[model samples]
Target: MKTFKKATDPNILKHVNALDNGEITTVSLKHIFHHGSSKYPNLFRRLDVTEENLRTQELASGTSFAYDVMGVNGTGFKYEKDNAVEEFRNISMNELKSSKLDWRDIGKWLPAIKNWGTLINLAKMTYNAYIEMGQEDWYDLGEEYSTNNTFGWEEDGIRGYVFASSDNKTLIISIKGTSMGFGAGPTVPRDKENDNLLFSCCCAKVDRTWTPVCDCYKGGYSCDKTCLQDSVDGESLYYGITLNLVNSIYHEYPNSHIWLTGHSLGGALSSLMGLTYNLPVVAFESPGERKAASLLHLPHPPAIPWDKMNIYHFGHTADPIYMGSCNGFSSSCYIGGYAMETKCHAGIACTFDTVSKLKWSVNIKRHRIQEIIDNILKVWWNLFKLFPDCKNDDECEDCGLWEYIE
Candidate 1:
């Protein structure tokens, strides 16, 4: 368990606003998790934050904080899928081994959901992870003080960053989202595959002319439920890889408080991880993943109250993806080879009414993490001086028009 000391920089302090009139604390990049397209597909690298790797700057609220900006390299641990599966099965016992949603353990690992400040910090951390791929320093460009910590992996498979508080008490797992626009990246194929598999109803079967990612679509609006479940549980996919990552992290940091956050696809994966382990999650502008959770057969555990869960979705009305309005062949998501058909998110939604209150029109451009930070989250509270209440949407329905045939 490596730890870092609290060393605040005056320059960082000047740029950042005081959080609740107190100095903003920072988190350190402890490890980088990567899977697929390598000798060790499932790789974990441990790194320490040094002065050169550490950057401090202004962010949301009157709060300023620091984060590590280090290059990704080094091998710590390699994850073996067969062994992990065997171990998870043995531990699950009678519980759903495939889903890993042992309801008996629900609410046992809830994260400390303190206030909006905590959520804002988590969002910033998520942004840090998302922008690391571009390798451009937002702080250097005077776009507010945000750190860029490059963690390189093969253009294929899944990757995420592990950030820890100075005290080593809390750890935030930040997942990367879809990176396909303009030109295609190496991961675009797999990224699109996962998006279609996880977010779409019936393997992204929009119409007869469309090609389904999986053979779950029976015909018309009918889908084979068994086939859908099987496709979602494929070990090589992003969801399964994410489950493995969460399990590894849980064992590695048993005593530390762990939370998950991400934007877009990353956010949806974070929410799924939160459900699997009953940990805390804060997803930003993500399409609804509740329907995907159902297909994965995640535990609802009747005894657990919805309020007791620590999953939170933060987004606004402007983003069509977040609003569940982006679908059909003409929609941006569909045109981009994505079937973002789900819109019923799990847990509480802490959403801002940017369309109604701020009079912003719904648009796909607003789905970017930077847009959320600069236009909505950063400005919403500053102008209104209050946050929209986070509430449960258990009644929300997804894929209402489709039928899942058993």
Candidate 2:
């Protein structure tokens, strides 16, 4: 939101024009601030251009324009060390070699690949956490959630499954696929067995033909009638799921806190539910549903503020799905090459590798997944540090060790 005084400065002008025309060069961007001197003495001070910023801008612009951004924070190298880049590259190559099928084939294989990959990743992370905690009797919640259907529901065209802990205090709802349907409610004791947790999983009925209702549909500045209906339907279904769970809990325990979570499209829906219903959500790899939510407002009551919302968007630098249209709700603080610092070596490596992978793959899905993974990894690493580790649990400490490296 900061306005640049050198908006008209020749150097800045050159860079902007070059970017607009799809010819922005590194030299031009680096020297953009040096255009106006005496007339705009503070121009250079206010308009220093960097590789990361350039990438952020490019991402905001939906990669339609060309910009050369460098990865200063060892993120570039970490990608290699983590082998995430190699894995993605291999996946893309394999997909391409096996691209003899049509879109229908792709649609089928894509979901399977994603679901399997997610299961594997979740298992690995859970196992590692278990090892770190050194708990032998720890329940393998991830495995249980993956296989069990103890807590499940189907109502109002929404179907969901649940995963709860032994304490019944924590709940995690996972909505699979791209539908708005999901499960709800607490776990019922099965024939004298007491329930420890309450969980639900749900997915929307993916109307492949159900185009996203937004201004894009009507070429307007606000939500059209159809768009509003779509938003309401989606939002209402999400709220219904949460309320059912809460109502069920109130009937039994009378006091419980619920945590919501989802992935990709589910993440977006979960965020919508959290913001509207005042629920705390921990969504992963969610795309921004801000546009729709913003359009619909909060039905009758206003939603929580941005600060109060505990939504964590986990995404990799290479994932294009997360990198939605630059003009949408997903545009806020979307870190790109600019925010990838070396101190956060993981971020730097992932960003660089993601960019490289994007350039090579050019496949939309691959690029999107890679980017989401990179970003999610960065966030996870930081979050992991928050728990009591060998290091200090000091609060309000500045963790920007990689800021200067870029």
The top-ranked prediction according to TM-score is 1
Number of clashes in model 2? 38
lDDT per residue for candidate 1 within 169-252, as digits (tens), equals: 667898888876765356777888888988887888887667889888878789988788889877778888788777877897
Off by over 4 Å in 1: 1-25, 37-51, 54-116, 131-153, 183-185, 301-303, 326-332
Task: Please give each candidate's TM-score.
Answer: 0.75, 0.36
Highest-lDDT candidate = 1
For model 2, what is the alpha-carbon lDDT of residue 90?
44
Candidate 2 Cα outliers beyond 4 Å, as residue runs: 1-157, 179-231, 234-254, 299-304, 326-353, 356-362, 367-406
* lDDT (CA) per prediction: 0.66, 0.28
**Model 1, poorest ten-residue lDDT window?**
69-78
Expressed as tens digits, the lDDT of each residue in 1-406 for candidate 2 is 2111112233322212122222111111221101111122111111233457646654664431121211010100011133332343244334422111111111100001112122223222211111111112222211123212322211122212233333433333443223211221121111001000000000111123322322223322222333343334432343333334333433443343344445544455555565544444544444445433433343111111233234444444444444432222232212221110011100001122334433433223442333344433334333432211111112211112111110
**Model 1: lDDT to the true structure:** 0.66
